[model samples]
Target chain A: MTSPWAVIIVVIYFCILGLVVGKWGKGKEKGLNEFAVAGRSGPWWLIMFTVLATWIIGSTYTATMGYAVMSGAIGIYMAMYSVMGLIIFYYIGPRIWVWGKVHNLYNLPDYIGRRYGDRRLAILVAIAGFIIGAPWQIMALKTFGYTTTALTYGALPEVAGMAIFAIAITAYCVYGGMRSVVVTDFFQGIICVVVVIGGIIACIYAKFGGIGPMFQQVLAQRPEMLVIEDTKYWTSIIVASFLGAYCWLEIFNRIFLAKSVRDLKIIARGAPILVGTVYFLVGILGIGGSILASVNVDLAAAESGLLTIFSEVGGPVLLAFAAIIIIAAEMSSIDSQIATAGVVLARNAVNEFKRTKLTEDRVVKLSRWIIGIWMVMVYFLSIGELPALIVIAIVTYEFLATMFPTIIIGALWKRGTAKACWASMAVGWIVCGILQISPVTQAWFGGWGAGITGAFFAIIVYFAVSLASPKDEKVEALFAEVEAYKEAR
Target chain B: MGNKLSRKSKTRLGFAIYFVVVIVPILALPTLNRLNTAEPFVGPFPRIIFLMLLDYLLVCAGLFALYEIESRRGDLL
Candidate 1:
C-alpha cells in the first residue's frame, strides 16, 4: 500500500499549495476586514466554487462511502442534504447577504448581536459557534490524517500526519486569511470535481465493467439499498440537514464575502446542480464500493471504501491522486472553519474585554494567532480515537442547528428579543444534550434524531418566549431598516 | 425575457417549485416503496434507481428554471 511515489506527489502538492499561499498571502494581513471577509470583493464564480468546495469535505467523501457500505442507497441521502441545504439557502441567503452588506457584518455573531443590539447575545453566539464548529474541523483533520496514514501503509504515524495537515492549513489560512482560503478553495474545488468524476468513470469501467454492469451487480446483490425507506430516522436527518444549512458558520460567512447580493443569488442558482451532479457521480462510486465488498475485496475499513476502490481499480498512481483529493477536501473545509473561529475570537470575544481600541493590524495579528492556537488544539484532538465520521458530522450539525431558530427567526421577527433568543438557544442545547445522552430518549426516539428534536423545541421556545416577553424598540427599528432596504431595492 | 413578476410573486414561485419538486417526492417515499422491487428497469438497474435519478433530474431542472425565470425579472438580481 505504501509508495514512495505517493510521498513524492504529496510533497509536490504541498509545495504548490505553499506557492498559492505566498501569492495570495501578500498584503492580506493588514486589517481585520481583509483577514476575515476578503474585503467583500469575491466574484460570483469564486464565491460559488469556494462554497461548493467547502461543502464537499471529508465527510462528503469518506463518511458518505461509509454510509453507502453500511446501508446501501440510503447513503446518498446524506449527500443530498447539501443539495437541500443549498436550496433552502437560495431562499434566505440573498437576504442575509444584503443584511451583511448593509450592516458591515463580519460573522454570524456580528449579525445576531447587531440585530438584537445585545453584545452579550453576540458573545454567546461566538462561544457556541466556536464550540460547535471546532469539533467538525477536528473530525475533518483526523479523517485526513487517518486516510493518509492508511494509504501510505502507516509510513507516517497518524498523529504526525494530522500534525502536518494542521500545520499546512494553519500556515496558509493564518497568513492569507479569507483571501487565501477562498483562492485555494477555488483550486481545490476544481480538483475535487475532476477527481470525483474521473474516479467514478474509472471505478465504473475497471471495477464494474461500466455503468450497466455496475448497476446490475448492485441490483443483483444489494437491492435493498435502492429502496427508499420512510422511517423517522431518515426523515429527521433530511429535515435537520435542510434546516441546519442555516447553522453552518462557514456557509453563512460566505454571504459576507460575496461581491454583491447578485453574486450570492447566482451561486444559489447554480450550486445545487453543480454540487448535486458531483455527489451523484460520487454515489455511483460508493455503489461500486458495495459491489467490491460483496465479492470480498477486503476493504480496510468502511470509511475507506472509496479510497480502496480507487487504489484497486486505478493502481498506485490513481491511489496517490485520490489521496491528494482527500487532502484537498479536508483543507478546503477545515481552513474555513479555523479562519471563522479566528474572526470570532478576535472581533467578538477579545475586543469586548480590551479597554482601548486595537489597531486594525493588531486585530488581524490576533486573528492569525487565534487560528494557529485553534489548529494546534484540533490537531491534538484529531490524534485521539474518535467516533464514526458520520456520527461526528451529524452531531456537530445538531448542536449548531440549535442556533437556527435564533438566527432565522430573529431575521424575520421583530418580537424576537435578545433575552428570548438567548433562552431559546439555551433550552435548545439542553434538550439536544438530554436526548443525545439519555438511554431512555435514545431508545424511544433515536431514529427521530436529537438534532431535529432540539430544533423543534428551539423553534417553539423562540416563538413562545418572544411573544410573551416585552418587545424591544431596537428590534422594531431593525425590522424597519430591513423593510426600508427591501423597499429601496 | 419578457416575463415580469414582482419579487413577492417570484418568491412564491420559488417556494412552489421547492414543494412540488423536492418536498412532494420526499413525502411520497412511503407510497413509492412499492417501486423498490428488484425488477430491473434497464440492464439490471432497479426500478427505484431510475425513479431516484428522475427525481434528481427534476430537482435540477426545476431549480434551474426558477433561477432563469427570476433572472428575467432583472430587478432582484
Candidate 2:
C-alpha cells in the first residue's frame, strides 16, 4: 500500500515550502500584491519557467502522447500549436507589461475597463476569461484522478483520487492565495523538468537501443508519425497559436506583475526557450510512446501516460516518481487557475456589486470560494464521458482567442474607439460560437484547423470596426498615459 | 563615418536572422534526415538539433520583438 519513494518525494515536495515561507516576510501577507503576483518579488527567469511548467500539465504530457499513439506524429503536430502560441507570447508579453504597470491594472478586466471606461464591457471580458479558463481546470482535475490512479496501478479509484488532489489544491490555494501557489509552482516546475527529461531518456533507452534506433523503428513501422503533411495546417497552427498566446489570462496576469518594461522584456524572451525545452522533451515522449503504443499499449488513464509506460518498462520506484511528477504538474496549473479566477472575479464582478467595496482579505476569501465552486462544477461536468483532450484545449483557447485583438491592440491604439471594442468583441464571439456549432468546424476545420477560422474572424472584425468607428477621448488618454509609462520606464 | 546601426536596425536585423538563420536550419534539418546515412542518430538527432537551435533563436527573436513592440507602440496601427 505504501510506496516509500512516493512518500519521500511527497516530503521533498513539501520541503519546497521553504521558498513560500521565505517569501512570506517579503510583503506576501500584504494586500492584493502578495496574493496575486507574489508581490512582484520574482525575477523574469523564474516567472518564465513557472508559466511554462504550469501550462505544460498532465493533459499536455499524457494526452499529447495519447494522440501521438493514436494518430501518429501528427498528434504532436497538433500540439505544436501551443508551441507556436508561446513563441508569439514572446512578442506581445512586454507590451502588456508596459501598459499594465502604467495603468495600475490588476486583472484582464481591469485593463479592459480602463481602456473603454465601460464596466459592462469589462464584465463581458471577465466572463469570457472565466468560461475559457474553466475547462482547462476541469481537465486538470480529470488528469489528476487519472494520473494518480494510473501511478498506483488502480490502487485508488479514479474519482476518489481526483477528489483528494482537488481538495488539497483548494485548501492550499485558499490559505496561501497566489503567494502559496507560486512557491508550490517553483517546486513542481523543477520536478516536472527533471522527470520529463529523465523519462524521455529512459523511454528511448528502453524502447530502442537509443534515439537512433527508436526513430528507425518508428520510420520502419509508422512513417506518418514522423512527418508533417499539410503546410496550411502549420500556418493555421501558428496564427491560431499566436492568438491564444496573446490572450491567455495567466500570461496577462504575469504582465501586470512585472515591475518594469525591462523586466517584462526579459521574461518574454526567456519564456519560449523554457517552454520549448519542455515541449521538445514531451515531443520525444510522443515519438517514443507512438512506437510503444503500436504494440497495443493502452493510454486509457488520462493524466500519467508516462507513468503507465514507466510502470511497465522501468519499475515500481520510477512509477512512484512519475506519480509525484504528475501531481506536481497538475498542482502548478490548478493553483494558477484558482488564483487568476479569484483576481478577475473580485475585481470585475463581485467588487462592482459592493457599496464600500471589498478588502483584499475578503477578495482572497471570495477567490477561494470561486475555486471551490469551479471545482464542483467541473467535477460534475466530467462525470460522464470525456471530451477529446485536444478538442477541449482548442475549443477553450479559440473561445478566449476572441479577446486577443481587443486586449493587445486596444492597449496601443488611441484611435480604437469604444464602439470598436464592443462591436468587435460582439462580432468575434458570435461568429466563433456560430462556427463551432456549424458544420464548418467539423467538416473543413477539424483538428488544429478550426482554430484559424475563429482567430481570423476575431482579428479582422476588431481591426475593421476600430477603423470604421470614431475615437474616444478617454481611451486616447489611457493610450497616452501608457506611452508616457513606457518612456519613463 | 563608421556606420552606426540604430536599435531599430538591430531589431530588423534580428528578425531577418530569425527567418533566415533560425527557421532555415530547422526547415533544412528534416531534409538532412532524408540522406538516411545512419540509423537512430541520422533520423532523429538532426531534427532534435534543429529544434533546439530553433528554440534558442525563438527566444532571441521574441525578446527583440517584445522590445520593438514596447518602444514603438506609437508606430503600430
Candidate 3:
C-alpha cells in the first residue's frame, strides 16, 4: 500500500501554492494586465521555471515514459520534436517578445487582435484556444487524480481523488489568478526537479545494480533506446519539435513576461538548457523503466507508468516523493490550462454574448467558473480510457506544427496578409484534426508523420496564399513599427 | 539584409548540415531495434556510458556552436 503522508503533502503543497499566488500579484485587481500578465513584472528565472514546468506536466511525464515502455527506443523521438520546436521558437520568439513587451499583449488571441487589427480574429483564436485547451485540462487532472490514488494505494476512491485535486487547483486558480499559478510553479518546479533527480538516481541504481551496470544492462536489453530511429522518424521528430514549440501558450506568455529585451534572450538560451536537462533525465528514467518492465512488469498503465516503476523499484517512501512530484507537475499544467481557458472564454466567447462587457474582475470570475466546468468535463472524459495517452499528448504537436508557420510568418513577415494567416491556421488546424481522428492515417502514418503532413500543408498554403493575397498596409506598418521598437531599445 | 551569413557562416552551415544529416541519421537509426547490442564496433563507442558521456560533450559543443551563430546574428541586439 502507498503511504498516507504523500496525499497530505500534496494537499498541503497546493494550499501553499494558493497562498503564494494570492500574495505576489494581488492588490491591483482593476486592470486586466495584472490578472493576465502579472503586470509584466515577472523575473526571468520564475518565468523560466513556469515554462519548463508547464511543458513537463503530468501528461508529459506519464505519457513520455509510457511511450518509452511501449514503443521502446522509437519513443525518444518525441523529445526531439520538442527540441526542434524550441529551436524554431528561438527565431520567432524575440520578435513576439518585442511587440508583447511594448504593447502589453496578454494571450494568443491578443496577438491575433493586434496583428490583424481586428477583434474578430482575436475572438476566433480565443475560441480555438478554449476548444484546444479544455481537453488538455481534463487530461492533466486525470494524471493528478491517478497519481494521488496510486500514491495513497487506492485508500480514497479514484473519483474522490480527482475531485479533491480538481477543487484544490480550481480554488488556487480562482483565488490567486496567474500570480498563484506562477507562485505554485516555483514550488512545483523545485519539487519536480528534486524528485526527477532522485528518480534518475533510483532508476540508474536499480537497473544496472549500480551506475556502471545500468548502462550495461540497458545496452544488453535494448541498446536501440540509446539512439534515434531513422531519417523518416528523425525528420519527423525535428519538424514536430519546431511545431510543438509554437503550440504552447505557456511559452508564448513566458516570453511576454520578460522584464527586458535581454531577459528574453537569456530565457531562450538558458531555459532550454535547463528544460533539456529535465527532459533528458526523464527520458533516461523511461529507458531504465522499460528495461525493467521487459523483465516482468506490465506496460499497460499508460498514464501511471512512471509512478508504477518507482513504486516497484524504490519502495513506498521514495514512491511518496515521486507521487508528490507528479501531483505538483500536474498542478503546474492544470493551473496554466485553466488560466488560458478562462482568458480565452472571457475575452472571446463571453464577449460574443452581445451587450455584456467583460471587466477584469468579471473575466477572472468567469475564468474560475470555466475552470470548474472544464474540470468536470475532463474527469468524465478521462474515465473512458483513451487508446494512447502519449499519442494524444503528442497529437497537439500536429495542431501546433501546422499553426507555427502562420504565427511566425504573421508576426515577422510584413507582407503576410491576414487572409493568408487565417487560411494557414485554418488549414493546419483542420488537417491535423482529421489526421488525428482518421484511422487510416493513424495506421499508415503512425504518431510521428501526422504532424509533418499537417505542417507541410499549412506552410504551402500559407505561403502560396500569402503571395497571391493582398496586403494590409496597416499591418505592414505595425510590423515595421515593432521592428523599430527593438532598434530603438 | 547585409546581416546575412558570410563565407565562414556558409562553412559552418555546411558542417551543421553534415552533422545533422549524415551523422545524426546514422546515430538515430539503431534506436528502433529491440535487442540491445553489446557490439563495440558502432560509430564512436560501444558502451552506453561512453555514448552518454560523449552525448554530454556533443551537447556542450552544440550549445557553443549555437551561441556563436546567434551572437553573430546579433540575437543579443
Candidate 4:
C-alpha cells in the first residue's frame, strides 16, 4: 500500500502544479492563434524542452523498459522511431515552420489544405489526424491509470486514476491553451529528466553496486536476454518506426509554434542528445529490470517493470519520485495532444465546415469545449484493458504514416495533385487496416509488418497517381512562390 | 551566426547525417546481430552493448557538430 505521506506529497505536488498552471496559464487566454500556437513565438529553449517533454511521454518510460526487459539489446531499438523522426525533422521542420509562418497556418491540415488548395482534403486529413492522434492520448491516459494504480498498490483504482489525471490535464489545457501546455511542459520536462535519472542511479546503487556489475550480473544469469533473437521483427520495427515518426501531428504542430526557422533547426540539433540521454538511461534501467527479474523480483506486469524496480530497490521515497516522473511525462503529453486535437477539430473541422467567420474569442471557446469532449472520450477508452502500449502506439503510427507521401512529397514535389493525395491516403489506410485486423493477412505478411507494407504501397500509389495526373497551374504557381520565399529567406 | 551556409547546403548536411547515423546503423544491425555471440565483456558492457553505445554516441556527436557548424554559419531564419 502507498504510504500516507506519499499520498500527501503527491497531493501537494498537484496543488503546486495547479498553481503554476494558474499563474502562467491564467489571464493568458486570447485568440485561437495565441491559444493554439503560442503566437508562433516560442524560443529555442522553450521549444526544445516542450518538444522533448511532449515526445517522451509515459510510454517512453514504460514501453522502453518493457521492450528492453523483453528483447535485451534490441530493446534499445525502441528509440529508433524517435531518433530517426527527430533527424528527419531537422530537414523538414524548418521548411514547415517557414511555410506556416509565411501562410499564417496553425495545424497540419492547414498546411495541407493551403499546399494542395483543397479545403475538403484539409478537413479529411484533420479528421484523420484526430482519429490517428486520439489513440495516443488514450494510451497515455491508460498508462497513467495503470501506473498510478500500481504505485498506490490498487488503493486507487484504474478508473479513478484515469479520472484524476484526465481532470487535472483538462483543467490546465482549458485555462491556458498552448502557452500553458508549453510552460508546464518545460517544468515537467525538467522533473522527468531529473527524477528518471535519479531513480535509475538509485536502482543501480541499491541493487548491483554500479552499471558494470549490473551488466555483468545479467550476462552471467540471463544471457539469452542479451541476444537479439527475432531479426525480422527488429528490422521491421525500425523501418516502420522511422516512418511512424512523421505521422504525429502534435510534433508537426510544434513547427508552427517555433519563433523562427532557426529555432526549429536549433531544436533539431539538440533534440537527439536530449532524447538520446533520457532513452539511453531508460534502456539501462531496463537492463536492470531484467537483472532483477532474473533474481525473482516478482514484477507483477512487464509494463510496470520500471516502477516495480524502483519500489524494490529504492523504497517508498524513490517510488514516490518515480510516480512524479511518470505523472509529469503523462501530463505533458496529454495536455499537448488535448490542445492540438482541439485546434484541429475547431479550426480545421468545425470552423472550416461552417464556413462562418467566428470571432477569435468564440473560436477559443469552441476549442476548449472540444478539448473537454476529447478528454471524456479518451477517459472512457482508457478505462478498458487495451493492447500493450507499444502495440497500440505503433498501430496509431501506421494509420498516421499514410500521411507521409502527402506531407513529404507534396511539400517537395509539385506534381502531387489533390486527387493523388486523397487516393494515396485512402489506399494506404485500407491496406494498413486490412493487414492490421485480418488474421489471415497478418499471419501471411506478418514478417514484413503492417506499417512498412502499407507505407510501401502508399508511396508507390502516391508517385504513380501524381505522375499520371496532369499538373495544376495553381500548384505550379504555389511551388514557384514557395521557391521564391525560400530564396528571400 | 548561421548565415554563411545556404539552406540547401544545411539540408544536404542534415541528410548526410541521417544516412550515416540513422540509416547505416539500422541496415548494419542484421550484420551486427551475427556477431552477437558470447563475446567477452568490453569494460562492464558486452560487446554488442558497447558497439550500440558507440553508435549512439557517434549520432550524438554528429548532431552536435552539425548544430555547431550551422550555428557558426550565422542565423538560419
When sorted by lDDT, best at the front, the candidate numbers are 4, 1, 3, 2
Q: Residue by residue across A160-253, what tens digits does model 4's lDDT show?
A: 9889889888988898889989889887787788787777887887888998888878878888766666767777777777776765668778
Candidate topping lDDT:
4
- Candidate 1 per-residue C-alpha lDDT over A280-329 given as tens digits, one digit per residue, 9 for 90 to 100: 76766676667665422433465677667777777777777788888888
- List TM-score (chain A only) for every prediction: 0.92, 0.88, 0.88, 0.92
lDDT (CA) per prediction: 0.75, 0.64, 0.65, 0.77
Model 3, A422: alpha-carbon shift in Å? 2.9
Give lDDT for model 2: 0.64
Winner of 2 and 4 under TM-score: 4
Scored by DockQ, the top model is: 4
**Interface Cα RMSD, each model:** 3.0, 6.4, 5.4, 2.5
- Ranked candidates (DockQ, high to low): 4, 1, 3, 2
Q: For candidate 1, write residues B1-77 as lDDT tens digits.
A: 88897676667576676656555554344644545554756454556656556666677676677677667765443
Per-prediction TM-score to the true structure, in the order listed: 0.90, 0.83, 0.84, 0.91
Higher-lDDT candidate among 1 and 4? 4
Question: lDDT (0-100) at residue A341 of candidate 2?
Answer: 87
Residue A456 local lDDT, model 2: 65
